[model samples]
Target chain A: MRKFTILAGLLLAVSLAQAQEYAPPKGDAHNGAALFQKFGCYSCHGSWGQGTGRDGPRLNPPPAFPVVLQQLRTPRREMPPYVASIIPDQGVADIYAYLSSLPKAPDPKSIKELQ
Target chain B: MSKRIKRRQFLAGVAAAGPAISLISTTGTAAAQTAPASSIPPVPNDERSLNDMPPQTQGKSGSDFMIDVIKTLDIDYCASLPGSTFRGLQESMINYGGNRKPEFITTLHEDSAAAMCHGYAKVAHKPMACMVHGTVGLQHASMAIYNAFADRVPMIVLTGNIGNSVTRQMNVEWNHSAQDQAITVRDFTKWDDQPQSLQAFADSMVRAYDLATTVPMAPVLITADGDLQEDTIPPGMEKKLYIPKLKMRGHPTGDPALVQDAAKMLVAAENPVIYVNRYARTDNGPALLVELAELLQAPVVDSHGRMNIANRHPLNHSPRREPTFANADVILALEPVDIWGLTNYVADLIGRPDLPPRRNPNLKIIHIGSEMLLTKSNFQDSQRYAQVDLSIAGDAESTMPSLIEAVKSQITAAHKSRFAARGQKLHEMSAKFLDAARQDVAYQWEARPISTGRMVMELWDQIRNEDWMMPTESQFISDWPFRLWDMNKPWHTMGGSGAQGIGYNTPAALGAALANKQHGRVTVAMVGDGDFNMAPGVLWTATHHQIPILYLVHNNRAYHQEVMMIVRMADRRMRSNSPNLYVGTKIEGPNIDYAKIAQGYGMYAEGPISDPKDLAAAIRRGVERVKRGEPALIDIVSEGR
Candidate 1:
């Protein structure tokens, strides 16, 4: 279950990378973890930002600060456009740092196919 | 919130004069029902109704009025589960839609609801309405919708929603609401609509009906805002709305000039062969295909499917038509997924994709199929088309007749010499393909862990000549046994992987079984264990309704594709390896007891078949139980990447 959570989180992380712009200013994983939980991001994205919310996409694929800034400005499809006003740069940075801190999702083969 | 749409405006909105009833109560069910054949009763049976709850303040659209609209569309039952967002709409449905307002057959989970719609529509061959509760509902529905998309089942899905303000502010509303609702189903639906105005809703709806019913049909979505369900127009607007009927069929008249030229090759080639597929179940495709085959007295190989030509037909050639295929100077492939398969499988003898596609130096090709423009929905790139000397695009039903006409126009008894020499030689080769395929099954059954080949062949002996539906999984148990199954068309094998979603087969098979319930078709959904584990709860739906579906769980453990990739990795890296591919891929420890799981959900269950030899009997048992009108499961334990 924990492994799946990590995987789901990583999925979101990957998508987040694609959905948002890149701007990792040497993010601090510890600070990122704090902000992620504080914002209730885990409720839907699982403990590490994998999807759990009925409709939330994964959040681990860390978007660099530029991508985060971009998401705030130019939103696509259904995701609401967020601005620095709604989520500050440092805060977004912290979340990104926290997600990047988690181990990348292990490939099924690397772990051994379930027997 | 405005409970009322100003009366005069409501009057203007209503295209017709006010009905006899002046009261707009959502709770007055009995009173609002249009007692006679017309949907909601215009005159309320005030005395017989539920007077305890006050009429809904938001108001009820004339129930009979809405019923009047639904009636025109020939809608019968509405499928749904409880949700506050749709309460007003349900009320309006009963009241306005009247007799046409489908009595909602609610289920526990939204997935089952979608599957029920799948099964229902398969049998009905038309769209059935199923409404879910906004964002969360749509999310839950994603898996089933994916299956439906893969199965190519047409459904009209409605979801309850609150506007953005409500989704943002109100807790009850926000959780279920989405800013862009259609995003949930964009990958699966043919079209989706979120009309802001009722007029737009109605208009988009008519368009939706048209699009969904067209060829290559699948489900379409339309979000019904909570606000719209109960909003009443004046009185008589139902008549102005119209939904179009779905239709598509095309024909290419074989040019008489080309026919003569092609006939010279076809009738003169001693080893001419005919390849057939999905055309068998089509309108006149089967008969016309048969006529052309009989004209040449050529053997027809059901290369991709079953019974395009009846197995017992005298002119029906045997399965070992390979030599005929090989020796023929010219071969005609009709509606085959393998016309390309043949040339590609023998590519080394010809050429590769990097260069221009080259066919066998000795063989000529005539290819006939419908579409040239392909979509990613099925992962088939349009550029992969085989290089054929003559590739005709038209309905197999349409083109077959024309080709048959051409064959009749030229071939004579003297032309018997055209087919005799190669026909005898080819007959021997078919026996080889058939013998090899059969031995292949035997060889697998003799192997250690469970083999998919033995599993399907054994299962076939159990359910042959019965109504069976297999979700076409690309790598799993799909093509290996295509040699044995009586497949006449694509529908015979429910190719439920167009979207290639992993967890789609279980629910989809459940749906197809449900659709086939009354017809006494024992629907079989052969799926990977991973696929089954994803939505095993659908078993409850089958149990709930006594739907007798033979849910075969191909429990080979692990994501085989990934495992294979890892093996390839080791091979590419020049490292000697063992099948440690079973690392995280196999299911073990508290390994799932699929039989217990099925029985837990009220299905008759069997297996964990340790021996491949018993695979046939286990499948037979599951089919027998389901044939008796109860759901059943057979979990086959196999070892594969």
Candidate 2:
């Protein structure tokens, strides 16, 4: 079990290193927004790419475009795999663009309601 | 004409007139009219006139005996809608029984009545009676009955039917009458009987009560025959009839040897996780689980079946089940509703293929629960089977003390330091998880259509200090309450509808509030728009009975869960999933005015409040009204999912 944990930690580190080097191809943000809703990405991930505790993870500062595409085609955990026949590569790229376009959430300390 | 007749004289006069009328008919009409005034005989002083008078009083009825049986079982309330088939029993309940113990609570629909019993049982720890008219009424209540059965909550469903076709008068009577009335809900309920005699009715009532209250409990049905309910107790038969004493059955406990084995595994494992659902039968359940988890310093994952643990406890890792389970070498599942779903991950894809187990493949599992004891083939409430290393057939809460004792006996001094270190690490992890949740909910925190997370936090801030209970499930709103609130009490939440049925929230919440009223607890619920619309009349029931609760409608204006599923389907087909997706699923075109509906039911209400800024004030007002013993509602137009 300890060996498995160490191996998992190493894999995560490699993924993080790879994430730093990757740069996504430029896509139209307007079309990306429409595509995000079209594919129903906003159902689990909220309309603004903010996720919920019980559903999806936060996607605003999304992982690398390759990682996102890989997850869509062959997903891990409970997410259903979207084969190439369903969502093409261009659609995945648009969704990535939409996620990247979302601004960072406001600091909770600055929000009076949260306080 | 000049003299008023005496009581005896009047009786004689009527007898004389009867003979004169017959004599007139026998003779010719012209001769009879001419002779009637002169030929009528003088009234006779007859002894039979005194004997012919009708008796002024009916001493006892069969329904009065039925009430006696109900009172004997100590059922607190009978929630019902008036129907002709049960009129005899209903009248006797109010008039003869004085509506005291097993008080009559009028509901607008039979479905609401059954649901009220479902919610009442979870908190009261006993069954309440739901009386319904036969056929149509039982059909109306079938979904709620199925919900109670699936939840393993005890309830007495008394349905009225005219078993004898001869006694059925109107079209409705014949329509409602059935040869076997219990058959409608027999598929779901644990036991059902249509008693032939009053003595049999008494016996069945006691038996049903005992069966319902036993471990692995479920709803039971007793069909009261309309004729039997209305008929007089036969001559000298009241003495023959007997109300049997209610037999209290002890909950099944695990075999001592097997319990010991489970304890040893839990103690020896490096990382153990206790997964629980519907395990907390009483307030003591949480304390027992706490003792067990702290002894081993194991993380506990509550599946929100009931309030199984204090949410703020450092060992509680509900929001982090995946990582906790991933590291677990041993798992002790306590009455899990779906053990297979918890241990394995299965995606709802095109073929619905089973994935590999989420936990360690060799992880030892110990199951302690009586879920298998009461199961039927027709309704599939029994979830898919999962193989376990040790299976103990017993009530988890009842078997907990012995398991705790066994673990104590096995633990050594060496284990204590290791356990403490494990506890510290878990505490740090729990704190970090909670901090992450706080950050996640901050996105769009000030949106115009209020975020469900912000809505939950605002409500929590106002009622955190009060003795509060949220009877409704929180899944629709991303389960923000479970993530954010400090839910320490047993009744803090009542879990979800056992069958995931819609229309459960409105009535069930009121039922829980009804139970909480006696304890002076402030009750709150957040219902979905679709659910509230299914049985909004339950608000009228709450207002009439004065069941205090703050009901907030999470009005997303669509069956949001269905909308998500439809979107997934469309995406799977590679079609447009949006804009047109709202066609069938949306609850709009003219959005429902829930505030107006609540006001019509005489409940204090506010909103269609859309702004996040306005939510806190509206919540405060609703809470105040609830505290003053009035039901209140706030309809918040909010984000879907």
What is the DockQ of the complex in model 1? 0.01
Residue-wise lDDT of candidate 1 within B3-51, one digit each (tens)?
Answer: 3344343334333432322222222434544443647656555775676
Off by over 4 Å in 2: A1-35, A69-98, A111-115, B1-57, B577-579
Worst 10 residues of 1 chain B by lDDT: B347-356
Show the lowest summed lDDT stretch of 10 residues, model 2 chain B.
B24-33
How does candidate 1 fare on TM-score?
0.65
Predicted complexes: DockQ each = 0.01, 0.46
Which tens-of-lDDT digit does each residue in A4-114 have in candidate 1?
A: 979989986787777555336666778777655443344324444443212244455644556555653564322334345544677777677777776554332231111
**What local lDDT does model 2 show for residue B242?**
66
Best model number under lDDT: 2
- Per-residue CA lDDT of candidate 2, range B370-442, in tens? 8999988888889898888999999999999999999999999999989999999999999876667678788
Model 1 alpha-carbon miss at residue B40, Å: 28
| CAPRI quality of model 2 | acceptable
